[model samples]
Target: MSESKKFSVYLMATLPIVFWGVSFAAAKVALEEADPLLLLFLRFAISLPLLLALAWRGGEAALPTKKQALVLIFMGFMGFYFHLGIQTMAMRTSGSGMANWQMAASPAAAALMSAIFLKERMSRTGLLGALCAFLGVTVVLGLGTKGAKGISIYNFGDFLITVSMLNWAAFMVVTRWLFRDGGYPPLFTIFWEVFFAALMCAPTLALLRVDVGAAARFGAPTWEALLVLGLLCSGLAYAFWYRAAAAIPVPRLMVFQFLQPLVGVVAGYFVIGERFTPWLILGGAMIVSGVYAANSHK
Candidate 1:
């Protein structure tokens, strides 16, 4: 890519990372008043229409084959439904900032999977990076021992955040598989993914698990939070992401993501008063180093 184009790609990728990082705080705010499932529903409800507006423009059918459709549905369930639900519940207790850095294990886990299934070989530096990433996890876990009495290795929310990151890595693997043969536009694929996610989540209201009536009690801040989550975080963020992914080389594109965890820490600090602990700083640095190490082709 040309220098100007690469810069544009970086700018595009940065948009979603910024939105998603701050979104952790938005989600925390929304979760204070709404159930995770309900918050997810409202998020999609706000996000989907806008995505559809953009995704279906110019009269494109952009339909998928039955198999590809199944893949998309499966991706939605794993990526949006189950994983996001876990994240929502976790972020409620974990707070946004620490929850962000807690996800350092994802790229390392992805590297392991690539080695196992794809037969990819990791360099010594890559292996070291993975170890550093998990070492950061240990550091975070050690810090947890200091905070809450009688509980160590962090809270359930932090654990769930780690779980969500693993799910996302699996989601990425499957997405890459679909990309190999799915023959769909990125936005179109995203639309269907969100569609299936919303479809799966629709029953949350009638399931009696959540007080669907609670929506009636939502005040302005809650509404505003969901709107931003759905509109900017979910909608435009994904749009920019797909555009950037298409524009940039995969390796170069991925390197930019290391900034996300760092951004999340800052956003979390200012947005929710979560402090930057020494452990967090050290752990996050290790994780960012690992992400670059793992993603680097050379």
Candidate 2:
């Protein structure tokens, strides 16, 4: 490839990861003004049209069957509704850097879940890596936060983020099952997931008796953060990620994912003034290495 072309390819790969990394801080910013349910509702509601457009561009008229539709609804709820809602709530107490570090372990979680649920074989190295990742998460939970007094006494915010990580892993396994038949186009399935998730969020907000109109009074920072979360992180970043996946080798492209935590740390520091502790660095390094090792077997 020419120098310019190579640059473009690397840029394509890097941008999406940057968007996603910054998303944790963005969510933190939005959470300052709005509750988790409202934040979740705004995110999917804003991104829905963009995802719908991408799905329609595929020109696939075949929709999911009734059985598949039910499955999709469940997937939507698991992946977006509950997963994001819990994570958003977690952000109320967790630092963006800590959230990113915990989430970085999710691939290991997913690999273990796949081995157990799908009967997939895991290499010894993969098993060790999974163990290392969980240990790293424990270290983070024990040492990463400000209020935690000791290993046994953990921050509630960190605990919620850990739950979010496992929930996401389960969602991935379910998504793999849904896509295994190759009946649904990836974009189409994603669109429906966001669509159904947004639909579910509406009733949730109503149940919570949240003042949806209160969002109009939010300051510029909150709106800007929400726009970045909705438009760039959810919409364009996903589209760019899929495009990058098509162009770059999967393994080579995955190297960029490791950069996500670093980006999150930088973003958290600058955007939210989150501190960079030695323990956070040590714990995060363990997570990145473990996830890298866990995924290496594939």
Candidate 3:
């Protein structure tokens, strides 16, 4: 690519990381007034129509084949509902920086899964990078400590977030396989995944019987925040992410995600008054360096 084109792609790719970084903060704020399931349901319900409209305008029609639909459904279950639900729940218990660092495991998980399933090979350097990243995450969260309340003082939130990272990596692997062989449109696939996930979560929301009045009481600021999360972060960001992933190789794109936690952690500290410690800073730097080293080959 030309210098200008490469720069443009970099900007486009970077935008989603920035938006998602801030989304951690917005989600934290939104969660103050909304339950996790309810927030997820609302976010997708509000965003789906717009996404479908875009898909239709782009000439996407009819769902994928039955087999492909099944794959998409599975992906939706794991990626959208399970992955997001867990991550959101983790955020309620952990700081944004910790959550972000936990998610840094995604590339490593993806690489491992690919080696097993796709017969791909991981370089020694990549393995070392992954190990460094893991150690950095451990340092950032101060793993294996005792709490004052006799609660075992473990970073369960960080662990949950890291599990979501594995979930997402699996989702990505399935998506790449489907897209390569199925000839499906990325937008259409994502729309259906989100749509199916919304359907699955509908009953959960009904069970919760979330108070609409409370949701409505946020007035303009709440609505604006929701709009940003739904439209820009969820819809537009996914669009750009898919585009950028298509343009850039997966390993390279994965490196950019390391920036996400830095943004999230700092934003959390400043916006939400979350505590920041030297350990977090040191660990974050290591994680970033590890990710860069892992992806430098591509």
Worst 10 residues of 3 by lDDT: 143-152
In order of appearance, the predictions have TM-scores of 0.78, 0.74, 0.78
Model 1: weakest 10-residue lDDT segment is 143-152
Tens-digit per-residue lDDT, 1-298, candidate 3? 7777766766777788878888766777778777787778777888788788878887874678898788778878887888878877877876665566656667667766766775555567866776676677566545222221212234877678778887888776666666666466777877888889989888877777866557766656656767877887778777667656555555555556766766666665667566767677787888777765665443
Poorest 10 consecutive residues by lDDT, candidate 2 = 145-154
Tens digit of lDDT per residue, candidate 1, span 79-163?
8888878988887678564665655445556555655654545667756655665665555444522232222357888888888
Top candidate (lDDT): 2
Task: For residue 53, give model 1's deviation from the true position in Å.
Answer: 2.2
Count of clashes, each model:
0, 0, 0
Q: Cα deviation of 88 in candidate 1 (Å)?
A: 0.7
Point out the higher-scoring one by lDDT: 2 or 3: 2
Clashing pairs in 1: none
lDDT of candidates 1 onward, in order: 0.70, 0.72, 0.70
Candidate 3 Cα outliers beyond 4 Å, as residue runs: 1-12, 120-152, 219-221, 247-249, 273-298
